[model samples]
Target: MPHRKVGSSIHLSGQLPFKDGELLGQGVVGRDVELETAQELARHAALNCLAAAVQAVGDLDRVRIVQMLVFVASTPDFGEQSQVANAASELLIEVLGENGRHARTAIGVAGLPLNTPVEIQVICTAV
Candidate 1:
């Protein structure tokens, strides 16, 4: 399943940066991919999370993001995981306003599925 719901909480599987069924940027940040591209990937993944949340809940306005875990495929020297994740956070705020504010964890990973630069998982609650 793309997401699971229990009571008021919804848990989404890791979302990758995909557009029109095509994977977006790939490779490790601070190496094969630039920071800007990685940021865009992050935003795209977050949008996927929101889309999954809507599919799970049937209505997006009835839910608010509670927390998020962002994994960035990056070189060991990359120190901008938070910066990459910020793009997603910003997108959430842009789409949901105050309801989008959330606790988040931005982590750098050695690799990710499909070598995608970023992946995101979201937790939301029905309001």
Candidate 2:
């Protein structure tokens, strides 16, 4: 597969540490909310994360995705990892069009960096 460069390397920061629909930033005491499971990441809307990752690279036209590795933090019995992975897959497809369709692996792990529900890494052929 050929490598295509779509955007520059940029880091996106400032992710809230809770599920979607949960209060963010400062709140009254005893009102703190948290995500107890990985599935919550989707509830918080993973498409946003996916967009951020894609944006970090810049122009999507130059992107020819070769492969995608989607990691989901979940409980041992959680069988919905694939569903969560689909969130990223769908986002990539929407952003990159036909070129976004590529080899992919959706995996469940005991944990992830900062208890995040999902993390996506990609390999692409640069134009």
Candidate 3:
């Protein structure tokens, strides 16, 4: 097995810098939140996650994203997780250029932290 370096294992947390208790509706709180739309929430989650990941590295030049996964907490009828995941994918390309393009997966789950509508993770190769 190939050994994974500590740098490669580093993970970052990204939450939309919305003010606390701003109220995204009955079950939501924070800025850029969509009260009734899963797609919008997914997009916000992806953007926030990527921003946090980039900040974790402290420099964009050291990044080589290998994969991305987005998790959407939603009701059973939600079928647009992939579209929401695109929000993250698009933002990464904007920030990292071609290097940001990556393998990705988007999934819908029953629930998440603070009843958040979305969360994301990234695997990156670091220099």
Q: lDDT by residue for model 3 over 1-127, one digit each (tens)?
A: 1123464564544343222434232233223344336445555555555555556666677776678878766567657678767877887788788878989998877766666666667777665
Question: On a 0 to 1 TM-score scale, where does candidate 3 land against the true structure?
Answer: 0.68
Give the Å error, residue 118, model 2.
Answer: 1.0
Residue-by-residue lDDT tens digits, candidate 1, 1-127:
9999888899999999999999988799999999999999999999999999899888879769999999999999999999999999999999999889999999999999998999999999878
lDDT of 1 at 6: 86
Q: Which ten residues in a row have the lowest lDDT in candidate 2?
A: 25-34
- Tell me the whole-model lDDT of each prediction, alpha carbons only: 0.94, 0.52, 0.61
Clashing residue pairs found in predicted model 1 = none
- Residues 59-118, model 2: lDDT tens digits: 556656566666666666666667765655676687768876878787767655654556
* Candidate 1 structure lDDT: 0.94
Q: Cα RMSD to native, each candidate?
A: 0.7, 7.9, 5.7
TM-score for each of the candidates: 0.97, 0.58, 0.68
Alpha-carbon lDDT of model 3: 0.61
